[model samples]
Target: MTHPFPPLVEAYLADLDRALEGADPRERSETLAAVREHTREALALRGSDDDAVRHLLEELGPVDSIAAAAAAGTPAPTPASGPPLADTLLVVLSVVSLVLFIVPLFAVGTVVWAGTRLRAGAGDRSRQKTALVIGVVALVAFLAVLVSHYVATA
Candidate 1:
């Protein structure tokens, strides 16, 4: 008999499929089916609450890791390397220069460019946090400079 899944389950499956994009077709199908079956079993045993679903997914770990394990016999895809030092430096410099009389737009642009690189690069938790913090601090500092300039000019 077919079982019905919550909307979140469908979304999760789609995300999982996307994560397994470059994997072998056969292995991908098997992995998807296995995950679905596991989800169904979890739903059956524990009520269909959001918490239960989250717990199940967490226990299964990330889809990328799962795909890698399934394809253990084959060479794994190259993981994303950490963000470049140049990108980090650009973000820091932009943020620090917020106090300069230069156009704020340039500083904002640099922060955005650096942030995109940090987010897109490999899953380096430390680097991600550093980039995020730097971005926020830069923005705040820039805004402060703008306000101060406006007040001074008036």
Candidate 2:
């Protein structure tokens, strides 16, 4: 029988499901349902499952981008903000950072600077904020070492 419908629909769904496999249960479920719906309707209308699948897959392109989009739907926080609270940890790191050759101080300074920028809400500049935080921490530690070393030697 001639495929009254396009095959791309099924292809699109298959790609979507494949991409969704590694996704969270909630996301997988949602995507599964949505993709199924789209495919079912398309195939039913065309009366050709295989053709519909192929056509859909061809038009939808790769599944990676779709997976990325799905993931982006709920963005993850930056590494700096994630975890055991860098704000407090940074102060400690600053001290540790200074113990060795003042390099750590520079790191501390960068971290602090980044944190400040973040607080100011740079909008799309969150990455900059993170870098600034690290930089502040490093810089502060470096300064601490410099001051200590100079005073100790002099």
Candidate 3:
């Protein structure tokens, strides 16, 4: 189906609609309309460029997570006025660990912790995802370095 929104926004809304399958019809319709209206208003204010749309979707969070909340008859938490302190700390530590390469295991641990918090919906979703990505990249780089050292020594 054609939508007036940009492709990214259309795809996101489609995913959200799919995720809401099996939910109450009234709830599903209301949720979709609310989301569409919210998206339109945000785009009108922020501009509908790809980056802006992407950021909007991130703030909205994962489609499955939203659908799950709806199915449980719970309102999704509104975006926090500020990023949570724990989320900020974890993201900072993840970046520092990656840059320093001083504690590869600790970097991996922080990523895992961030993932758990993300799944439990305990912090800023976008920040948690960022931490996860940084940690994984750091772990992979650390492993590559170790492998190279072993090969060179042997």
The prediction achieving the highest lDDT against the true structure is 3
- Pairwise lDDT winner, candidates 1 and 3: 3
Q: How many steric overlaps are in each model, in order?
A: 0, 48, 0
TM-score of 3: 0.49
Off by over 4 Å in 3: 1-3, 80-154
Q: What are the models' TM-scores? A: 0.44, 0.35, 0.49
Worst-scoring 10-residue span by lDDT in model 2: 75-84
**Candidates sorted on lDDT, descending:** 3, 1, 2
Error of 1 at 51 (Å): 1.2
Winner of 1 and 2 under lDDT: 1
Q: Which parts of model 1 are misplaced by more than 4 Å?
A: 73-154
**C-alpha RMSD values across all candidates:** 12.8, 16.3, 13.8
Candidate 1 vs 2: which has more TM-score: 1
Worst lDDT window (10 residues) for model 3?
A: 75-84
Model 3 error, position 142 (Å): 63
